[model samples]
Target: MTETPETAETPFDRAAEFDRQVRTLVDRGYPSLAGVGPEAFAAAVAPLRDRATATTGPCDIDGGRIPFLLVVARGAAPIEETMPRTTLHRGRLPGFVDRSFEPGSLERFVVPEEIGLPDGDIYLLLDVERGEEFCGVVPGEAMKTVAERKRTPLTIEEGVALVTHFPEVLAKNKCFSLGGSRCGDRRVPALWISKRAPKLGWCWEGNPHTWLGMASAGGRSAG
Candidate 1:
């Protein structure tokens, strides 16, 4: 007996096909995310997914006034329409936005002063299928540092790999953690790690002994 490909498709197959189609479209120069691979692409897209999956309320900054810029794939109308407006503004991804935003459109929001805009236009990540993605809002002065940390058009795997390989680098230099998590049904854990000061002779101030212990344990585990 020969195994035959069934016409009936499972959700997994459909999802895989969707991923492949998205990958192909992205690789062919869709803009918002021009230079990333499948993994980084997936990671970048996660934020959008997270927004879509959110059941209680939309994600907000500055008490619902500031909009979270979302970089989504072109022609992704259903996904866009489904996303919570309170949490995100459906902006075209870097390469895709050139034609999307018109002058004086409310959809476009200036990068906040506190966040520090990059010398060039900032970009966001959109992962429609999985409901997970990230936002990259680096300031002008930090562009070089951000560039050193992650390559353009990153993939989900690459993003994770980067966070894993340079955990301390990101923690100390970036002033934030790699992933986000919800807490106690009300607040989100905005975990940020502090950079080590050159003259302080300590990593996290008041946590020197703990840091040393962890380091020693880590070394032992690695060995």
Candidate 2:
């Protein structure tokens, strides 16, 4: 007798898994930034900058909304960027720290330490070009729980389908591309899909991949 094939999971399933992982991390205190020394903190955040560079294609932080640089220097005082003059300062570090703790804040800032505190004269710097940057420290156990949750990786086909079916929603939500080409299709109206929706899975508080920003007017009209 022939055996039956197992059903493949859908994109929604994979996204749900990702959400579960995020929730688990949040629950277990996965994104806390504590106990990390200055050097380790800087080293830890290096990859996020690299990712931003790779995705944005070597563009200067000038005029950019998100921060690109994460520096852990030898002082509690903020390290200022010499060139731009407008954005370099100590007060900015809090914003970066806050991002890790607050839900809906991670998309705004990338926290490398995720769950550690800077030891001694360690200071953090974020490369903010256009918009502002922010961060915060969270409980360790909470972050661990978040990390423990499982994630379902997305296949290329599923990724494409998600973008195609929900172009506007994806673009508006900033959920489609983590670090790659900008979502290039015509901007669609922002569709807010709650993360707890039963159709998807009861996980995050909001759509995992959606942003609130509007598309450029110069881009193709969505009407």
TM-score of each: 0.19, 0.19
Error of 2 at 119 (Å): 23
Name the runs in model 1 displaced over 4 angstroms: 1-12, 30-39, 43-102, 106-223
Instruction: Give the per-residue Cα lDDT of candidate 1 at 67.
Output: 15
lDDT of 2: 0.23
Deviation of model 2 at 26, angstroms: 23
Cand. 1 Cα-lDDT: 0.24
User: By TM-score, how accurate is candidate 2?
Assistant: 0.19
What is the C-alpha lDDT profile of model 2 across 1-223, one tens digit per residue? 0111113331123223223322332332212333444445445443343333332212221222221222222132221111111111111211111111245322222223322323433222222121111001121222232235321112112222222222222321232211111122221112122321101111122222223222110001001
Query: Per-residue lDDT for 1-223 in model 1, tens only?
Result: 0111223351123233334434533543333334546566556554344332232222221111111123332223211221211111122221111122234331222222323212221132321111111223322222233334442222212122122212222222222211111111221112122222111011221121211111000000000
* TM-score for candidate 1: 0.19
